[model samples]
Target: MKHFATALLCGLTLAWISTVTADQKPNVLIITVDDMSCDSVGAFGCELAETTPTIDALAASGMRFHYAHVQVGNCFPSRNVMFSGRYPHNTGVEGFYQVRDTQYAHLVDAMKDAGYYVAIRGKVTHSTPYQPYAWDQDLTIIDGQKQHIKNADSYYRSTKLGIQSAAEANKPFCINVNVSDPHKPFYAMSSKGQVVKDDNVPSKIFTADEVPIPGFLFDHPDVRKELAHYYSSVRRADDCVAAVLKALHEAGNEKDTVVFFLSDHGMPLPFAKTALWHHSTRTPWIVRWPGVTTAGSVDRQHMISAVDLMPTLLDILDLPAPNAFDGSSFKPLLEGGAQPGRDVVYKVYNENSGGNRSPMRSVETKRFGYIFNPWSDGKRIFKTATQGTMSYRAMRTVASSDPVVAARLQHFNHNVLEEFYDYQADPDALHNLIDDPQYQKEIEELRAEMRRFMVETNDPILAAFDKRHDLAAVSAYVDQVQAESDARRARKRTNKSPQQDDSLFRLVVPKQVQAGQAVLVKIRHTLPKAMAEQQFHVTLKNGDGGRVERIVKTASGDGVLEIEFDVPANLKTKSVVVSAFVGPEYGKHHLHRTKGGIAVTQP
Candidate 1:
């Protein structure tokens, strides 16, 4: 017998390549959560009770949605639009730099080029070019003296060592996890600082009269003691999503995993994190995908985002989603079918997380929402970090004895340039309806569908929202498109020069400043040609913690410096962090470091 039929045809071709790589790959997981709040769970209508029994048993074994949003309501450009399925004006990443265009293809580099095994854990600096999501087990600990894992027995031992290293690399994994429990400095203490507690963080806390508040805030008692410490940090992010789905059912890969669960936006309060408001870019998506979603289903007729989560997980792993993805493929609303042009849901709010700009734009629809703002002119004061919380200082101390908390703290400090709202009769967007008259034909059909989706998304603020009905030609076309986009990003940072022992500073100023106004900081640099006329120094610092200022200058000879300053006529700071340098001790040659917030307001 010719060597017994060539060793039984090499053992039937290695058992048909291990049964077609274990029945064509599956395991993904995801999880996410930071800042949370899409009605904080319990199958989304969370009016308290067990505040999210493991995200309502992962939305009772998955497929929740009900209008999922988040294109950008902060958090590293809404997680770089869920790993670059694109948007933040096509991933120039409207905030947080570092994605140096590897020609868009990320969902963990297409699930690590199809073989899978990616990993990750906490925020991990909102995932940037780590060699195309090169994370085979990261466990992110965003600096707080590391040994992280704020409960649920170290999130079930870091999701059972990332499912035993993707089941010992037999592959088919993805992981992610990122659950920094209900964001904002909430709970988690230990290394002798205290607060942590036991049985996976539950010594039952949530009190401030049993929480709830939010109808866009102001229920006082310091907004129910910060919604009882944000519902105990959303019950420690639903016990790290039931310890990563009980480490995917003790690594038997919970019936070939898929998971998902969401939230990377909303609830870090004050009209929800950096406001695009409908509880700030909605969220709580949920999913599951075991025999393709249908467990306790809900969908609510298509309206997705977070840039359709990397083409619906590359159309549920059958892969191939690249035509430079501006997101498509809801995988027919995840197989329960019905996508039909997926009606409305668009939002944006450029530069926040203190790199202040405040732009804002919106669209919504499933009974209108609208918005627009463009830094609402009445002296721009929308400072962030939820305006130093405790429910915005208990609604600015009962805003002069409450006229509905002084018109909701004057629409959270000055805002009103078209707002609209109806959200099926005010879903907490407490009445703006852009000058009512029964919503002037749904505000001209949502301002012509937000100017045809900002001129089909080429939106660099679509020529200042197409000169918003002439506010002096939208402030002279937004100051000539921000001085030709800052002289084309200062001639692409002076033709990228730097590195003979580097040096290329930059301070530039004015994104809004008022208190007696004077401004003009500039400072730019490029040195190294023998430190070209060095002298520097700068400083500034007020980012609402007031007083710092300093000055010094010099650099000219093709190294620029400028400087003007003034502003301080009782400046009570709202922003202005700057900082610069060139040796001789002031942060000894530190150069530049601004990263947003120059606002200042109140003249």
Candidate 2:
């Protein structure tokens, strides 16, 4: 305990936290379920009876948000927004891939710096900026054994452990308990349709006939069976929630702790998981801040995004929020006050789990929703996690006989460039009113709103939006974005050290260069001011030192330095390493250095 305090004292940088005593600070407990829709809870409007009794109870005792949405539909990006108070582009976590060197401070970082004991349970990798996060306690593993994700009691034990450990440390607790139920490999069935046995069982198991089909999906027997499994998983998730809250009560911190409950995103199904539709981003946001929020209250007047979670919680604790946050504190809304500009929310999706680039942007209001998909060029197939589901398979089986089903499948495979939904009448987003002349005025208004959001956030796909009417311009932008995405994936794969991301310069070289041909080496940098008067020293050398070339050039005013070197015809090595150094004066101690590899071919 003494060592822990000493270590925290050494690392803690928030000097303002010292003014508040440990008892004055409230514990923060965030309970998140995976792949759950907002309508899945009975309190929110799940037709399936008792699907989430524990969550419904929490809503009854807390403040339920009726128009809460996540910034993204996928797991990692959505959870990252909840913690970092930033959009996917700002955090560089646009997909499932890890962004090791994030410029933003996370929720845990703020809580820990404020003299709280931070911990996490499940979704350990997805929730944090990177894996092996410096949590005061990782409840995922205890006594050298990893807790089972599906087991409801595992969460109870982990929560109890976190609370007791925080008590021992004499600090407020901020623990994120992520339950893994309601995701894929749901309750009773495997990834394949085979039945499976598990020790952890839901209190009430659902049958296909009893479960209600979501509005976004087709009504099929296979889909019904899948929904049955999903509902059963939701029930188990309810049990996990009950267990966690019970642990909090047992520790006698129920009133002293502020509880937050929400799903990472909507269901993991077609048109619901990865797509920027109504159900994709809508989340059941519940907050139980004792002594602050009125019980049994619902906030339907304001639309909140998951991005606001970080700043709002920090505000609740009276902690200073980082200036880089894209989200503002909704503490006023939670305190039964009104806030303007709560009528709309902005959403984005960049890449999927498989590293496929399908950039999308959207804006949603109470009555309308508009989405712009730059990657949908009518040729590139959209890849997502939903294609592997039973519902999609059922759609494929019936597509041959049903033209409607066939069209739906094709639309799912290749989306159109733009989509507009009358959300008031069609919450499922079943119909696209992009060409409806009656709603042209409303559609134009939504487009203007989306454009404002894109410009405000500095969205990368703004060029595509600006030239959406021109297919050629949109196609060019899409291609450029895809190439950049591929390059980023390659860099992340090869560069392990986070410091490599801090390099002021970037070197771009072709894969192969002829021995007698002129080779071009491009140096890119963001430090235009620092390199305005500097020079670039470029060198190309082989492993055996049989061939070497050197060139020096002044930095270009456009932040890109292009240098050409002629390779010797007598070059014998199969490859060469290209290195570039930027400095005001030529010397070994330069400002920045970058390297790339190129292959040598005989001409």
Candidate 3:
């Protein structure tokens, strides 16, 4: 722990080469929202009754990049690409925040290296890694908790202070204010309305009947109401966006600032949050540039993805984009020059919240979207999506009357299918072109593209699963899991069913995560078999005495699990040894694949 900190601290002098003299370089302000769609804003032709005068003005004040799409739609993946300047597929990270990539060069480190004051408000996945990279100071832990509050004002105030502090210190500034408020179960509404302890209450609740359903999701009046509430959250987010723009202008830095507003993925729901489908991975991107971009102009014909943020930002700043960034620069499009199509925009989907699994890969272009279905099971990829958002009462109501609904609800508890789509003709992607004979030529072409992508990216999953087809190899592997399963049962295990043989586990600790806050560990698993009958446990140890343990038993087949806990003040520093174990009584099998020490952040 001390070694990495010393390493970072020792290198502070070399981290930056002051460029304050470059008056032409624009100040950068990136604001990312969660679970939002391109169609929600008035500028995007939103048919809803939401008020987004702030965002509309942002579009009007600077340039609006209409074709601005995110790299990967899921929260973690989207932010990974944005901050690291690497494609999500290439970074080898998917849904959930557990997957850790410590080797990559984060934007904070790079910007600081180039003589910029990097102050981040709000949240950017990996921005404030519980572990450290290059932030100058830490915030006051809100409510005496080890964690800082994820608030909208915190972001704005932090940015304002960082900018002021930087100028006072005579340094160029690059600030990122991340707001997790308008995210799920919007928490930012208290200022505008009566405060509620539960985050589930809607800030601007609306009935489902009021929402114009996107074609991708099945129509239900409740779904429409949910959509309405979702738009309300977007409006709340716009308010903060307006505030940030105002601050930039008031500081006489608005014209000098390069602002970007986007979401990690679509809204959280059946077709929205967890898929590689157009709705899942696509985003509404509005980049407000003072000089480089022309105002009120849209770029529909140009296809852009989230992975491009890093490289594009560097390009706009007239700096060299790192070779490590997988995306190409589209500053040309932003400049109103010749618009060329990206050869391919790659995307991947992994574990959903609470460990539900549905994985797929996509290769999208201006005219086509070729999907890869490595798992061609009997069900649809998005069938179980609605279950996540449905309440227990709502699910029980349907379960008693309709067996089909009962069955779907049951399937929703499991994982299945991989799909392909033709986004051009079927822009909404209602019809999947995977098995259609008419599109064989297109299918083959897409297959080649997918294959080449896997080869180039060197994805470990594809590399390991290439031709290993058979239930037997996995079946035997299950026997090992069964031994552990039986031991767990002996210890009063309630979870039962076949256990998955393949699950990639990693331990993540934040740099600034206090000595008292619980550590959150994320795991990605594939249940070639079910595990309703068994329980799993992950444990962490530091040499001998100080240790932590977590138990997880999921009702679903495939998914990810996050276990958070508080650490003792005695266990100070920023690193710890973590191990994953399953079963009971003399542990028949243990996964010790990683002897690696997890990282911790020292704020």
Clashes of each: 4, 0, 35
Q: Give one digit per residue, the lDDT tens place, for model 2 in 379-491.
A: 99989989999999998999999998898888889989999998889998889999999989988998999889878888777878999989999989878877877897797
The window of 10 residues in a row where model 2 has the poorest summed lDDT is: 11-20
Off by over 4 Å in 2: 1-23, 492-603
Compared to the true structure, candidate 3 yields what TM-score? 0.67
Better of 1 and 2 by TM-score: 2
lDDT of candidate 3 over 127-210, digit per residue (tens): 432233346432222211223333334444455665665676577678776655446564432322323474333224445577
Predict model 3's lDDT versus the native.
Answer: 0.57
Best to worst by TM-score, what's the order?
2, 3, 1
Best by lDDT: 2
Give candidate 1 misplaced runs (Cα > 4 Å): 1-31, 36-71, 74-80, 88-109, 112-114, 118-158, 161-165, 178-219, 229-231, 238-263, 266-268, 274-400, 412-414, 417-457, 464-466, 469-603
Cα lDDT computed for each candidate against the true fold: 0.70, 0.82, 0.57
**Residue lDDT tens for model 1, 1-603:** 223223322321221111124357877788888888888777889898876666776676557888888877878888877887777777766655444655677777677888887877776666653322556556442111133655655666667766765766678788788877777666643322234544445434687898878777756666686677678878877766666666566666666677787898888878888888788888889877777667677988778888888788878778787656666778776668897877787888776644555667898967678888766777768877788777787678878787987888888788777788877778888888687687798799888998888877678777777778767665565455445445645665575534323346666777787777677778667766665567777766554222256787666345667877777666443566666666554323435454346677785
Q: Against the true structure, what is every candidate's RMSD?
A: 26.2, 15.7, 14.0
What does the lDDT read for residue 178 in candidate 2? 97
- Distance from true location, Cα of 458 in model 2, Å: 1.4
